[model samples]
Target: MPCGGGESLEGDAAIYRQLLSISGHRPKVVLICARATELPCEEIAAALLALGAGKVETLTLGARTDGEKPAFLETVENADAVLLLARQPLRLSTLLGGTSLARLLRRRNAEGMPVAGSAAGAALLAEHMLAGGESGPTPRMGGVMLAPGLGLSNRIVIDQGGLLGDRLGRLLAALALNPFALGLGLDADTAAFIGPDNVLEVIGSGALTIVDPADIGHSNIADAAHNAPISMLNLRMHVLVHGARYDLDFRRPLG
Candidate 1:
């Protein structure tokens, strides 16, 4: 999967060319999002065409209803890889795959196809995700925690800046509640193209924020109420600026 660092036209075009090469020319590019109508998809399609993508297709997961059948995973299987647009909703369940996004993810994992997500797109790729919706102060969380993603990387992703306002604190708090994963906060227009070797390479023009809590002195989640401010916490974070690279092959601080 290719991650164009920024939203610049030139940058996206360049990445599209690289992606075309990576996928062996014949690639199926899947654009997943709820507000597909509002985005500049036509421009994106043209860019992909210039980059040598055999075909570019967009799937609207938000338009589907309970009675309608979801798009087939075979459609994705035939493509070189999938590209999930930022803000695309990805959800999953046991009885049935809730969304087309969820079904596609499951299919990719089963076949071991390369997958990539931007912002919310990236968040859904994680083992567990912070489900956003209408609710009280407490946000509900549920997804395939152990679901085998495209296996691009295992680091947990958090979308920040835009839709996720001041999400870092909440993410850190969540990590305190469940201390077994590394947190990556991707700013708007920023992306870390993670390879199978666990190497995170900054691609976009923005920054990739990493929160590793291995050395935190103390966390006050014991008595903290829901949505309450956390205290007495020590944490370290690294900002991977554009063009920089860090290896996640070994779970340690990015050196």
Candidate 2:
């Protein structure tokens, strides 16, 4: 699930319940706030506990010693659910990259453990992450930057906290570069519960924007000058609200 950040706990109540259910009522949830060093883990942990998590453990990444790394990986490996909090995606990649914790998280996700990320957390879940870029107006060739992510999913590239920021251009630029990947722009308080089959069900008070460039007719992205505005034709976009669903494989909204 990709949350658009800001008061997401209340906005994502239904998703929280669903995640808890997936955990079989009570779950050992590990909250990783490695990217947001300024935020207090205790506060986030309290919120998760109040949301009905069976047990909550906060893991801070940067300060850990070599001796502490093993225990940290073990903690994550044993979790029934793992939540990546909102922050800068680049920081998450820097801290968790090549670490045992990253490897274990991937393994657990493959083993069916529920993993949810909000904002930057959501961006890191994709194989290619949108690190940073200008928002508002049309997309520009150099306006967006792409970086390696956690490799959770290659079919989709996510951009969160978008509606408020008018970051659709960022998502568009990402898809222009990687036409094979679907672009998802999650508004605040919104989420997409992507299933194993890559069918995403929308939930929350806001909307989820899906951008598919599979049939684009034209674009100057390949030859556009650095920082120049990009032009494209025949791009498809879908605006979905709560209870709506989309099929990534078919690149269309599901009825």
Model 1 regions more than 4 Å off:
1-11, 14-18, 35-37, 62-71, 86-104, 107-112, 132-154, 163-165, 253-255
How do the residues 1-255 of candidate 1 rate in per-residue lDDT, one tens digit apiece?
324224576755545555566566567776655544344667777777777778888655544452134343555656676766654334322211354545656566456566766445566566555444322223223211223333233456454434233556556655665566676766656666666567777765566777777667776667666556555356777877867777664655454
lDDT of 2: 0.80
lDDT of 2 by residue, 82-192 (tens): 888757888777777666777788888887887888768888888898888998758889989899887878999899855634788888888889988998898877778
TM-scores, each model vs. reference? 0.73, 0.93
Pairs in steric clash, model 2: none
lDDT of 2 at 106: 81
| Candidate lDDT (C-alpha), each | 0.55, 0.80
Question: Which 10-residue window in model 2 sums to the lowest lDDT?
Answer: 59-68
Top lDDT: which candidate number?
Answer: 2
